[model samples]
Target: MEKIILIGDSGHAKVIEDCIRSQGGSVIAKLDDRYQERFYEEHLIKGPIALIDDLLIDDVKIVISIGSNHIRKSIVERLNIADEKYATIIHNRAIVCNSVKVDYGTVIMPGVIVNADASIGCHSIINSNSVIEHDCVVENFTHISPGAILTGNVKVGQGSHVGAGATVIPGIDIGSWTTIGAGSSVISNIESNVTAVGIPAKVIKREGL
Candidate 1:
């Protein structure tokens, strides 16, 4: 079994831990700068994020279990670990098609259905119960929150967050750093760095506006 070092100790980390276990991988240690306590009842609290610099041992993999897309991207950039050292975890319950491509540092949570020809970029999160349709492109550092549905050929840009239960119609393009609010029904293209919300999603605020 492969040994993994999980970087985060919150509720999100707990879910990632379970996904790793379900894949028959063992979590050797957990690192969190904020909470020094154990991850749960069984996993021990290893050390701080600073310890990552000293982890030069072979065969040990790392996974950023943080929920926030920005924070996860920052940590991954700071660590700069080798591509092979970063683990891509897909829960056993996920239904990923054979033609789907999941990049390194991405996590596909339980009940995720990634259809054919879908490309999920590095360090992205396909949260539990989400449905990513055929030919969809999810760029790096994006988070498709739980229960969100991306229809066929939908494009989610880098560093974006599609909130829980949101439904994006087919061929819609969501730009980078944009935030789609929970339960939104996105019909048209959403521009970069804005927050969109409504039955037919509309931009409520632009970044730094």
Candidate 2:
């Protein structure tokens, strides 16, 4: 069993810890800004989130439990976290097909259903209760928020954020750096660096340009 350190200590962090345990690994410690005092208390300890550079051990690996794409990327950049050493944390209850390809540094939360031939890119976040159908391609640095649903053959571009409870129809191509609002329904193709909102998911702005 490898000694692992999770990067967050929130409720999501706890869930990832449980998943790590179920994967036949041991969580040696956790680092977060929320629980400073509890981190020093024996087994379930905490530490600084930004101190990963100072705290990373030779045999230990780091797992990002944060659901936000921006926050996760920022922390990675600030701490200079290694992509090769980053761990993918998947919940035990997640129904991920064997044919699915999940890249490095990605996390599939509880109740997520990733069907066959789906490709989840590097450093992406597939939050809780999401369903990704077959042949769906989610690009790098993207965040599929909780309860989102992507139909078959849907392609979400790099650094995009599909908000919570949102639904993307089949064969839709969502461009890079786009943000789909919560509870929205994407019925058409969305372009890069834009924010899409409402039921039909209209483009509001060219985000991150």
Tens digits of per-residue lDDT for model 1, 1-209? 87888898789988998999999998887888875533444655477787776664788898999988889988988888788899999999999999999999899999999999999999899999999999999999999999999999999999999999999999999999999999999999999999999999999999998
Q: Point out where model 1 deviates above 4 Å.
A: 35-45
Off by over 4 Å in 2: 33-39
lDDT of 2 by residue, 81-135 (tens): 5677788878788999999999987878788999999999988888889999999
RMSD of each: 2.0, 2.6
Q: Compare the candidates by lDDT and give the number of the best one.
A: 1
**What lDDT is obtained when candidate 1 is compared to the true structure?**
0.92
Residue 148 shift from truth in candidate 2, angstroms: 1.3
lDDT of each: 0.92, 0.85
Candidate 2 clash pair list: 39-45, 39-46, 193-207
